[model samples]
Target: MTIHAVIFDFGGVLFDWSPHHLYRKLISDDHERQWFLDNICTQAWNTEQDAGRSLAEGTRSLIEQHPQHEHLIQAYYDRWHEMLPGPLSDGVAILEALHQADVPLFGLTNWSAETFPYARANYPFLRCFRDIVVSGELKLIKPDAAIYHASLRQVRAHLPDIQPEEVVFIDDVAGNIEAAMALGWQGIHHVSAQRTAARLRELGVGF
Candidate 1:
């Protein structure tokens, strides 16, 4: 079936967000920085917050578990803005091009609802989407079929006739792509805007 709508994952695909952006400045030593990311403020731990745990609660709980790294734990959320510098220009260009073409656009992201306001406020490009289903707001995360279904529900509000086979889902995570594909949606594992744009063109989505 021809793809009629596009779904985007925000963090790695369109936004340049990384804890290393902040931690690199804080921890000079690469080894220690990697260690801190691995053991202390882990991806899994951060994902819990993205899945709807409050930032304050997550930070406080981690601090309690690792009292010695209280300062670092606190800094994780206290300086969270540092982790996101800006949008990826290439991806933003693609989004804008798609917008100009009047293609239906949507967002499905696993981002903390509490922190998402900052991005929504600062990033003008986010306004392009017909709707964005945030995992944090729904207390669900990527690779989970529930959140994908929720995104579909949101999309159906505007695109009542859209089918899973007619939607293209773009995500940086392979697992997220796989999940979407499982549900009969076209999937693009976005590694770069150039690649994603090329794939979109191949799928006949006009710029």
Candidate 2:
């Protein structure tokens, strides 16, 4: 079937989102860094936070776990913008090109509800998408089939006749691309804007 829609993953695909940036800014001591990773980084608290849990509630829960690191938690939350960079203008240009071609565009991102607006504000091209499915809003995360299905549902709501194979999903994470492919969607593991543009052109998607 001919490709009709294109889905893009927000974080690593368009913007450079680095957890190490947050860790470096928040944890100076090596011991504290290890502790933070053990108690906070990969914990269920973070999972819940990414799954629509309120920031204040997540912060409070973290503080309760490590009273001594309350200030650290506050600082990290206060300056969350430091973890993200501007969108790749080249990628946005390609997306805009696709948009002009009447190829429906959507964003599938695993972002916290509390921080999504901030990221969106920083990246104006985010508004160009026809639909956006944020994991946090649905209390789901990527690599989970539910989230993929949810994204499909959102697209289906608008273009009800669209088929899964008719959509192309682009992401920097191989795991996410794999997940999308599992759902019978075409998946592109984005390396660079130039490569992506070339791939899109090869797919007969006009620049």
Candidate 3:
């Protein structure tokens, strides 16, 4: 199928998405850090949050279950801005090139509703896309078929003839890429700008 659209993951693919920055800033102890990541940063808790659990409710649940680590809850809430440094200039250039080529661009991201506006302000390139599907807003996160379906639906509503195979979804996480591929969308595990550009070129998406 001729690729007609490109879906980009915001965090790692387009921006410097580092979870450890907040993790290190919050949890000082090494052992406690590992434990917190294992328990809280796994797919389950994130999936629950994406499934409409309020941030306060989710944080409260974690605090209640892991009372020993309750102090870290507020820190997690406070440090969201630390995740995004700035837009990856090279990646943004590629996205702009795609847009110039008249290819539809969309975003499928696992971002919290609370932090999305701040990110949008910081990265103007985010607004360039035709469609933006955020997990927190939809109450459905990535790797979940529902969210992917929702993203596709949103884009299709705008451009009725677009097909799933014609959409290229890029994410830094392997699991997200796998999930998109499973849904019959072209998926790219973003490593570097060179690789991303190469992939797009191979797909006949001119830079």
Candidate 4:
């Protein structure tokens, strides 16, 4: 099957998202800030929220384990928007270019449904995707075969002729790219916008 569409990841790819953005202000010491995120507010723990738990529940549960950092834990949800500085215009430009070329665009992201609204509300470009299967809403994250398959199934529903090999997946994480490739989709490991645009053209799938 010929490539028919491009799928993108939300954070790190289309937008600038980082906990350090929020923690930088809360913890002035760079090392201590890393320590806080590493030990106290770890990505593994946060993945639970991305797996569909509500912000209130995730925050309350963490506070129960580390009461001393309750204030900081709450701050994670309170100042969540601060973590997302803004969208990546370069990536947005690629998305627009593809959209203009009539290439179907889709999104598969590991974002908390609870916090996803902030992004959806702020990034109008997200409307470019024909569909976005959020991890929080699906309780499934990237590198998981289920989420990738779900995205394919959703796409197939709309474009019946589309096949697994007919999709090009763009993502920042190596693991996500590997997962998509394993499913037979062309994978672009997004390092920089310049490199990504070049890769797309090299694959003959560019706008």
The TM-score, computed over Cα atoms with residue i paired to residue i, of candidate 1 is 0.99
When 2 and 3 are scored with lDDT, the better candidate is: 2
Q: Residues 1-207, candidate 1, lDDT per residue (tens digit)?
A: 588899999988889999999999989999999999999999999999999999999999999999999998899999999999999999999999999999999999999999999999999999999999998999999999999999998989998998999999999999999999999999999998899999999998988
lDDT of each: 0.95, 0.82, 0.81, 0.90
After superposition, the stretches of candidate 1 with alpha carbons farther than 4 Å from their true spots are none
Best by lDDT: 1
Looking at candidate 3, the ten consecutive residues that score lowest on lDDT are 42-51
| Candidate 4 accuracy as TM-score | 0.97
TM-scores of the models, in the order given: 0.99, 0.86, 0.87, 0.97
Clashing pairs in 3: 50-139
Residue-level lDDT tens digits of model 2 in 161-203 = 9999988899998989999999999888998888888877777
Sorted on lDDT, highest at the top, how do the candidates line up? 1, 4, 2, 3
Can you give the lDDT of residue 190 in candidate 3? Answer: 92
lDDT by residue (tens digit), candidate 3, 1-207:
688888999876778766566788777888888777777665477557656677788888888887776776656656667756677888888888887777789998887787678888877787679989989898888788999999999899888998889888888889999998999999888999889889888887765
lDDT of 2 at 25: 62
Which runs in model 4 stand beyond 4 Å of their true positions?
A: none
